[model samples]
Target: MTDLAKTDRPRTPVLDRVTLPSDLKGLSDRELRQLADELRAETISAVSVTGGHLGAGLGVVELTVALHAVFETPRDKIIWDVGHQCYPHKILTGRRDRIRTLRMGGGLAGFTKRAESPYDPFGAGHSSTSISAALGFAVARDLGGDPGDAIAVIGDGAMSAGMAFEAMNNAGHLGKRLFVILNDNEMSIAPPTGALSTYLTRLYTGGPFQELKAAAKGAVSLLPSPMQEGARRAKEMLKGMAVGGTLFEELGFSYIGPVDGHDLDQLLPLLRTVRARADGPVLIHAVTKKGKGYAPAENADDRGHARGRFDVLTGQQAKAKSNAPSYTSVFARALIDEAGRDDRILGITAAMPDGTGLKQFAERFPRRTFDVGIAEQHAVTFAAGLAAGGMKPFCALYSTFLQRGYDQIVHDVAVQGLPVRFAIDRAGLVGQDGPTHAGAYDIAFLSNLPGFVVMAAADEAELVHMVATAAAHDAGPIAFRFPRGEGTGVEMPERGEILPIGRGRMIAEGHSVAILSFGTRLSEAMAARESLSARGISPTIADARFARPLDRDLILKLAAGHDALITLEEGAVGGFGSHVAQLLADEGVFDRGLAFRSMVLPDRFIDHDAPYAMYDDSALNAAHIEAKVLEVLKIGQLDRRA
Candidate 1:
């Protein structure tokens, strides 16, 4: 760590002078560079407090300053792709006072949200949608909507997704006036993987890359006449880099760069020239380093892609020690164990190997793991193909990200009756990342598909059993969802059992009202059971492991044996509870005068906060479960606070 690194909160003189993008207009070039440095420091400090995406914001400090200074913003829309890199943007756009409150309840969103600020014309959480959104803004301006230039700052990782290409193709075809600044940092959440990444690397390592300073000065009309000759040579290099004309040029846009993203002198002049003279679409390839200034981040593997609240002096995170392993790790180990027994077991992830805990599986069976870069659509279909070929494929993805592949899931896997084991991680309300990243709809969506077996893990042990069950089942599609954090401190089993399909195990049996839990909420249901027992109301408790098959026998038996029944799950309405209700209605169980209720996530989006707080807001916690029981049985008064 340097002198700058030694101080947790570095002085921000230039940053303190201004609060908005317009403030950059009057500052000289030297002052603006100073501002960028301070902005970088401020970003690090804020994330050190709030704990979120750090590397991305650091990578784009200069670019963020340059874009705000060059573009008119609000009027001239600047859409940030994936929005993880928008922390600095948030500060400059008049949200500095609330910086520490980012990703917390009632605070600023971690991503760029339209409602958060005027400068944030488009919101984002997932990657690779910026170009399409920018094109929309451009088209909207042309058609007499909010008139302004549409600019999108996207990362190389986001560009690797298929949607970026789709948007680029359409933008090229339409020949709209748009700006796409590609922040090529050689890394996304994981080191970006694909042919395109290799191509971009070739551009960086190519002979002309060293002459970027001279070439950049010459390439723009603002420079002296001597640089014009260098501009011609640089254009030739660009063509070579893109093969038959630069890739963006072939897509009908003016392609500029392989410029230094961190250098204000290079970025400012180029952006000024583009903003002044460009007529059609333009793609600026700015090469940057992830975790640009901070030594601890630059030296780390992921460049501080994400973190918990950390000590700025040492860059050590402040995470509480948990005795139990996380649900993600349990799934990973169980899959690795199963793969050891079966050679045909393959793993696939859409640019989230580490996030889904598939990195270990990839390391153990290198040939068997496939990372389809940010392309969930391709990942699902590829897994279907592997399954069709008689190989067991586990397509692991976050529940929210899996939404991108729904078409593939419905047509390619479900319709084809392929045996693709879908390991759905983050299957409930995700903390900090907020509503955009919430895994709330998978149960409802997957359960509706015929021949699709949907299951949820009630605990880490159950997750292991589901993994084995998914591996053994060679029928149609099978999915098992598990939530985001560490599991209950349950003892580990020697190996997982291939649990019986469509069957639920009873945890406890008692009188009056039975409580059925579908997923990790089983723990909450049990807690509620204890409270109920104190009032001489011992409610039966069971885990409905399989949601799609309805756990028919268990549900029907529970309803018959109890006066009032309640269903608990971490998903939204129309999920396990709805399925259970439909089964009861079909059987005329409701006609037997049995009171029933279903506790689930409310019908609106829950903002970022502590996981327990978000669950409390959603009214799916143990206290809420107890209240539902009291309400249904008409016993203890509804006093959640008590």
Candidate 2:
């Protein structure tokens, strides 16, 4: 190790020395801070290699270091809301050596996992879950008569969600022993909006607060004991009227500091004070910067909310040759094309205007586009309400985030049969983000809802057609899902046209085997088709557009004609393939001898890597698909030889 590396290395470093929380107790405060700095450097290097979450981890470095240093973790629960900020926590808790492989297949997860570390009391990927998880831990501790603490670290962005508010209300009403750290960075991915952000701003700025406190202390020190008692009562009354914590106070928690989260001098002493004093619920508002030490991320558009590998000095992204347009860009262009013609069209996103390709729409029709921050449930219902009010609303969201609004999909839109169009992006394995960010469950959840028309795009051209199909069909709820990255270099459609619902087209005609694919996996299925053809095993290929309201006639025809049916989808169990299996089972089509295999995401959560590598691990790649096809055919050949 170099001289700088030598000084940083623990003589039995807290980061490398301890795998479990119990091992954290012996370390001194000075050593803990050194460990924090080391953890930060390790995280930055690891994410550069693994290409995962960046800014969130950087912001939480000191907080993670301080929390572990003060508290007995695992025994005393600390629940991380959104879990994106857990990388530093992972580094200090015995996973430092494995950090470089973060988010890769069979490596450490990008988010907190209960199974991965005992220090992670509750697993989380979604935002705004910490308060509830911490509350649960609090109640469990009380019932078991365990002397332990429950701390929840939530960001300003997550505080916008309804669930966070609900948890706060319940925790306050119960008056349990819980500590809620509102990590106020004054932004989520973007600058936070609403009344709460304004209130937090007042609490932290210390403009009038510092002046009033000094004057009051001077007055109290000068008074006699009898006069001081009277002054104390008056001071309490004036402070109550002036301070903004009435909201948290009303909710029943003892609220404390809008402290400087970045300053270790302020943070360590304040944390120790809070640890010693107060019994009931407490809310500590700690203000910090998203990209504190890194200049590039600090000045970026979204505060480098999610970043790829970049130059450490200049902070420019590593360049790659563009072969084809990304799926997000394609979706954006297609939406722009549709919106240009239709005046009634409007776009809405749940805090992901950029991620879901709604930025161009926001630019074109500023009044028509809505960026409802981190509130997926509200975004869906809000879109449904817009549709009911005689406007075409396209609620663009990621496939994973849409799962947060599953109830809204069933209760508000599908049940009512509202005309809410869903432009679901990231429909498959998202490289580097790992399983937590994977768009694996939307197909399963949405397909099961009634009166829902679900379509998966095979390419950018098909995405255009699907978008047009959604716009034209104003009678009920409709959705089209596409994968994260770029599309296949298919020719772009000149004009948007609607495809017939409950119908699919054959890509190629063949005998013996029919390969049915849904969504982005169509490209891989085509490759498998070519490979199988070269071996004299010609196979049929079809893109099943609609997962729900399945193409009954097309699916049945393919199953009857082909000796074997191989169904493929870039989703989890009980998705497109499962739906096909259900239809085949219902019709008794499987009574006749036929080999069937449903190719879907594995039962385990997939890790982050390149999209192709992730697919390969889950057996969804072209090579694996070809190998599976050969294995099935070989079994049939053995019977024929017999």
Task: Please name the candidate that would achieve the greatest TM-score relative to the true structure.
Answer: 1
Cα lDDT, model 2, residue 519: 86
- lDDT, candidate 2, residue 269? 59
Across 350-439, the per-residue lDDT of candidate 2 in tens digits comes to 777778888878888888888888899999999989999999999999989998998899999999999999999988898877777899
lDDT (10s digit) by residue, model 1, range 1-642: 124465767788888888888999999999999999888888888899989999999999999999999888779999999999999999999999999998988999999998878999998999999999999999999999999999999999999999999999999999888999999999999998999898888876763332223344454456333334546677566544544226666787767656789888878877887787777888888899999999889988899999899888789999999999999999999999999999999999998999999999999999999999999999999999999899999999999999999999999999999999999999999999999999999999999999999999999999999999999999899999999999998988989999999999999989889999999999999998898777888889998899988788888999999999999999999899999999999999999998989888999989899899999999999888888888888876765465
The best candidate in terms of lDDT: 1
Determine the C-alpha RMSD for candidate 2 after optimal superposition of all C-alphas. Answer: 4.9
Candidate 2's C-alpha runs over 4 A off are 1-39, 145-147, 206-243, 586-588, 592-594, 631-642
Model 2 worst lDDT run, 10 consecutive residues: 206-215
- lDDT for position 407 in model 2: 86
